[model samples]
Structures are given as C-alpha cells and as structure tokens.
Target: MILSYTNIAIKLALGLISLIIVINITGKGNLAPSSAIDAVQNYVLGGIIGGVIYNNNISILQYLVILMIWICLVLSMRWLKTNSSFFKVAIDGKPVVLISRGKLDTEACRTAGLTAHEVMFKLRSNGIYSIKTVKQAVLEQNGQLIIVKAGEENPRFPLITDGTIQLQALDSIDKTEEWLMEKLKEQDVENISDVFLAEYENGNLNLVKY
Candidate 1:
C-alpha cells in the first residue's frame, strides 16, 4: 500500500512538471487558449495526465513516452499553423463579421453559431445598447466580440493577417483589393505576401512585414 501511494505521488509530480514544460515551450496562450486548437490541446493534455496518474498498469517509462509523443505532435501542429496560412485557417478559423455598416448580418451570426439574443447579450456586455450605434463588429475565434462603434476614430479590424487579405475587413471599411494594393504601393511595399500584418486607421495603412 505504501509503495502504491509512493508511485502515485511520483506520477503526480511528473505530470505537473511535464505540463509546465509543455506550456513554457508552446506559449502562455495555452494557459488562456484563444483558439480552438489551443483549448483542445489543454483539455487533451489534462485528460491524458488524469487518466494515467492512477493506473498501475502504465509504468512511468510508458507514461513519459506517451507525454513525449503528445508534445511532439502538438509542437508539429503549432509549427505547421505558423508556417502555413491554410493550416492556420483550418485549425483556427478566421474571424466572422457579425455587424457591418451598422447592419446585422444574420448569415454571419449563423456561421458563428450565435443567436440574435446572444449577439445582443454580448453587445450589451460591451456597453453597446443599440445595434445602430455599431459601425462594425467581428466575432473572434475565441468567441469574443470586437466592436467598432459608429463615428469612432476609425475601425480596429485588421486589413490583413498572416499575409492574407481579409475581405470581410475590407467590406466593413468600404475598401477594395485594388485600393489596398495601391496603398501598399504607396508605402513602397512591392509584394502583399511580404506583410505579416496590415491595418488601416485614420486614413493610413500601418504595416508589419516579415
């Protein structure tokens, strides 16, 4: 009985240490996951550790091997998400535009799996009582609602993220691809893919290049 208890204690310590190491290696985002993948990884890691901690059949060596394999899989996925835009979108979907030009987009609401009441609730939580007062609203991948009120100092949504143009953002701002390309040219940016992030506010295109 004492030996069994000792083994459990050892397993608990190892599990805690493994979790901390993985979080540090991955990023603090795992602590408060902002994307579906991050949330899933956290849940799965917890489940794995919890499921194995009490099992006498699974030796410490086997447990460590399982953890190592899981860590490698997570790291590979993160690497792919970083290097490939398609994978990033596939893993963490792009933001959905819920409101544009002071109008509600029911289709977007449906796409986001949010009902009218839920949208209103979120807006109300943000101190927005009237939908008409909103100039633009986007539902982030993390389920947070980002609002740009009417007559505010420009909108806050990004024109480009991870080298891809956001068409919804452009539509919200009443801009076009041609206009964006022209602005990029004005800023001496020869290629769209060179930009890591681009935002338009107060009549200026701010760029972060890779």
Candidate 2:
C-alpha cells in the first residue's frame, strides 16, 4: 500500500509540473476571456484539474492524451482565426455597429447581446452624455465598444511598410518612386535598405531605422 501511495504521489507531482508548463505555453490570455469561446475554454480547463487531482485513477498517459486534445483544439481555433473570417466571427462574434451617422441601431444592440443599460454604461464610461455626439459606435469582437465622434480625425492609410518599398501601395496613394526617395532623403536616410519599416501616414512617410 505504501509503495502504491508513493507511485501515486510521483504521478501527481509529474502531472502538476506538466500542467504548469502547458498553462504557461497556452498563456494567461486564456484566463481572462473576452468571448463565449473563452468561457468554454475556462470550463474545459476543469478537465486538467480533474486529471491532476485524480492522479491515482487517471494515468500519466491519459493526462497527456487529454492535454494533446486541448492543444489541438486551441491551435485549430487560432488557425481558423487567421484563415476564415466567418469562423472568426463564429468563435469571436462579429462587431456590431451600435450607432451610425448619429443614429443608434437598436437592432445591432440586441444582436450584440447588450442591454440598453450596458450600452449607456459604455457610452458614459467613454464620457459621452448624449448619443448625438457619437457618429459611429462599434461593438468590437472583444466586447469593447468604440465610439467615433462626428468630425473625428480621418483614419490614415499605411504605405511602404515592413522594410519593403510597396510599389502597389505607392501607386494606390498616387505617389511615385522619386517622391519616396525625396521623402527618404529629407529624413536623412540615404537608402531604403536602411529602413526597417516605412509607412506613409497623414501625407508623410514615416521611416524606422534598422
């Protein structure tokens, strides 16, 4: 009986060490969920707890098997997040337009599963007393609402990014290679090769050095 107990203890220790490493790799982000899928992950984490606590009955092999399954599920979700926009929406719900053109869309609110009280709370938190001040309100997939006031600064487009001169991007913005070279020269940058990243924002090319 003593021998059996010692073996069980060893298994429990090993299981704990393995679990700690797994949790670390999976990340603390899983702990604070922003979506329904995150809620499901928290629930599924119970299996790890169960396996570790019931080490006498659950073998090390069984623990590994379950953990592998969990890892695969997480990786698959990440893959879907990158590959399919539809799947991304299914796991992390699509953003809903709460207010558009100074008009509140009650249907969008209902679809986002947010109560009127919650919407008001979010707005007030953003220091918006009246909905009229909001030109656009978006309920982001992460359960955060973004409010854009009328006459807000125009969103800037990025061009010539990531150390590579983006000819297409330059063409899209109606800029030529000579213009880019001139901008680079003004920044005291001799060549594009020196730039780790370059982007045109607000009609200016911002360059990052290597």
Candidate 3:
C-alpha cells in the first residue's frame, strides 16, 4: 500500500512538472484561448498527460519520453505553420465574409450554418446597433466575427435591456418610449416585456428577444 502511494505521488509530481513545462512552451494559446485551435491543442496536450500519468506499467522515464515526444510533435507543427503557406492554410482555414457593403450576405450566412439572428446578435455584442453600420463582417476561423463598421458611424448602445427600459440610453439616442413601442410593434412584439434587448442606430432599431 505504501509503495502504491509513493508511486502515485511521484507520478503526480512528475506529471505536474511536465504539464507546466509543456504549457510554458505552448505559450498563451493554451493559457487564454483566442481560437478553436488553441483550445483543442490545450485539451489534446492535457489528454496526453491524463492518459499517461497514472499508468503503473509506464515508468517515470517512459512518461517523460512520451510527454517530450508530444511536445516535439506540437513544436514541429508550429514550425510547419511558420515555414509553409499550404500547411498553414490547410491547418487553419481562411476567413469567410458574412456581410459586405452594409448588406447581409444571406448566402455566406447559409454557408456558415449561421442564422440571421445569430449574425446580428454577434454584431450587437460587438457594439454594432444597426446592420447599416457594418461595411464588412468576416467570420474568422475561430468562429468569431470581425466587424468593420462604416466610417465615423454613430454609437448606439442598448436602450431596452431584458424587459427593462433604460431611460438614459433612450434620451441619449433622442428616442421616445412611444417610438420604441412602435418599433416593437413593427417587429410583432407586443410589449416591452417581450423585448430582450433593443438599440437604435442610423434610423434603424436593432432588437433581440428571448
């Protein structure tokens, strides 16, 4: 029993050390994810450690060897990405244009398996209050949207938030409650309670509901 505990403790210590070393080399990609590849690489590296750490048959030296191999493979892939364009493009796909020239590209949306509502939601989350403000929106390889708003566009933040009204936001945008209700009616939403979020920009009302 004591031998088993000692073996496990050693494994844990070695595993943690190996994990820290690998993560240090992997850089911010494994720490704070900016893309799907980063997240996947982080998991795959962790999965390697998980699979190897507790195996009784594998000696600590063997474990180190296995982990080092993985690190080398990851570094080789990184090197290829830097050295070869084809490898880079094949591994990381090019960005797709979802919206262009202030108009929704319905075909691109369909190709990306994204709904109009989702695109607008992402846009709104990025502080875009109206579709007209967007000159081009690119769907990044990591599934994030990169929106290029029209030049020197006005800022319009949320006025109605989750069934509650923000009177200050309304006044700043020069809109009235009656106008908001009319906009809601135009969208077939009956009451303010039905509205999840709403913003007005460039003579257009951007609304989202539960």
Candidate 4:
C-alpha cells in the first residue's frame, strides 16, 4: 500500500512538471486559449494527465512517452498553421461581418451560427441599442463582437493582418486592392508583404511594418 501511494505521488509531480514544460514550449496561448485548436489542446492534455495518473498499469516511462508524442503532434500542427494560410483558416476561421453600413446581414449571421436574439444580446452587451447605429459589427474568430458606431472616424477593421491583405476589409471600406497599393506607394511603401498591419480611417492610412 505504501509503495502504491509513493508511485501516485511521483506521477502527480511528474505530471505537473510535464504540464509546465508544455506550456513553456507552446507559449501563453495554452494558458488562455483564444482559438478552437488551443482549447482542444488544453482539454486533450488534461485528459491525458487525468486518465493516466490513476492508472497503475501505466508506468512512468510510458506516461512520459505519451506526453512526448502529444507534444510533437501539437508542435507540428502549430507549425503548419503558421506556415500555411489555408491550414490557418481551416483550423481557425476568419472573422465574419454580421452588420455592414447599418444593415444586418442575415446570411452572415447564419454563417456565424448566431441568431437575431444572440446578435442583439451581443450588441446590447457592447452598449449598442439599435442596429441602425452600428456602422459595422464584426464577429471575430474568438466569438467576440467588434462594434463600430456610425460616424466614428476610427478604422472599422484592419486592411492587412500578418502581411496579408484583407480583401473583406477593403470591400467594407468601399476600396479596392489597386487603391490600397496606390495609397501605400504614396507613403513610400512598395511592398504589401512588408506591412504587418494596415488600417485606414478618415481618408488616412496607418501602417505597422514588419
């Protein structure tokens, strides 16, 4: 009985150390997950530890091997997501425009799987009472609503994120790729890929460079 208890204690300590190592390697996203993949990783890690900790049939070496395999899989997925835009979108969906120019887009709401009542609730939580008062309402990938009130001079959204042009943002602002390129040229920026983030507000362009 004493030997069994000692084994359990050792496993508990090793499990905690493994968790710390994973978190350090993966970054803070595992601590406060913002995407579906991050959340799933957390749940799966918890299950692995929880299920194996109390199982006497599993040796410490076996448990460590399982953790190492899981970590490798997670790292590979993260690498793919970083290098491939298609995989990024597939794993973490892009934001949806739920309201544009004071009009509710039912199709967008449907795509986001949000009902009218839910939309209203989100708006009300953001202190917006009427849909007409919203210049734009963006449903972010993290399931948060970004509200832009009518007549606000602030940029509704980023024209570029992570050095990629956001065509949807251009469309929302009634602009085009050609217009963006010209504007960037005017500001002595020749490469769109050099920009990390670009925002347009009140007929002015703001850029954050890589």
Q: In order, what lDDT does every prediction score?
A: 0.86, 0.69, 0.71, 0.84
TM-score of each: 0.90, 0.62, 0.61, 0.87
The deviation in Å at residue 69 for candidate 3 is: 1.9
Which parts of model 2 are misplaced by more than 4 Å?
A: 1-31, 155-210
For this target, which candidate reaches the highest TM-score against the unseen true structure?
1
- As for lDDT, the candidate ahead, 1 or 3, is 1
**Candidates sorted by lDDT, best first:** 1, 4, 3, 2
Candidate 3 residue lDDT tens string, 61-158: 88778767867776776677656656666766656777665788799899888998898899989999888877667787788887756663433347
Scored by lDDT, the top model is: 1
Candidate no. 4 TM-score: 0.87
Worst 10 residues of 1 by lDDT: 1-10
Residue range 32-105, candidate 1, lDDT tens digits: 78798889988988888889878888899898888888889888888889899988889888888898878999
lDDT tens string, model 2, 17-96?
A: 55466567666532676677866776786667554654556666776677677767866886786566567768887557
Q: Each prediction's Cα RMSD?
A: 2.0, 7.7, 15.8, 2.4
Give the clashing pairs for model 3.
none
> What does candidate 4's lDDT look like per residue over 39-103, in tens digits?
88889988988898778888988988888888888778878877777888998888898988889
Evaluated against the true structure, the overall lDDT of model 1 is: 0.86
Clashes per candidate (backbone, < 3 Å): 0, 0, 0, 0
Candidate 2 vs. true structure, TM-score: 0.62
Query: Global CA lDDT of candidate 4, please?
Result: 0.84
The ten-residue window of minimal lDDT in model 2 covers 153-162
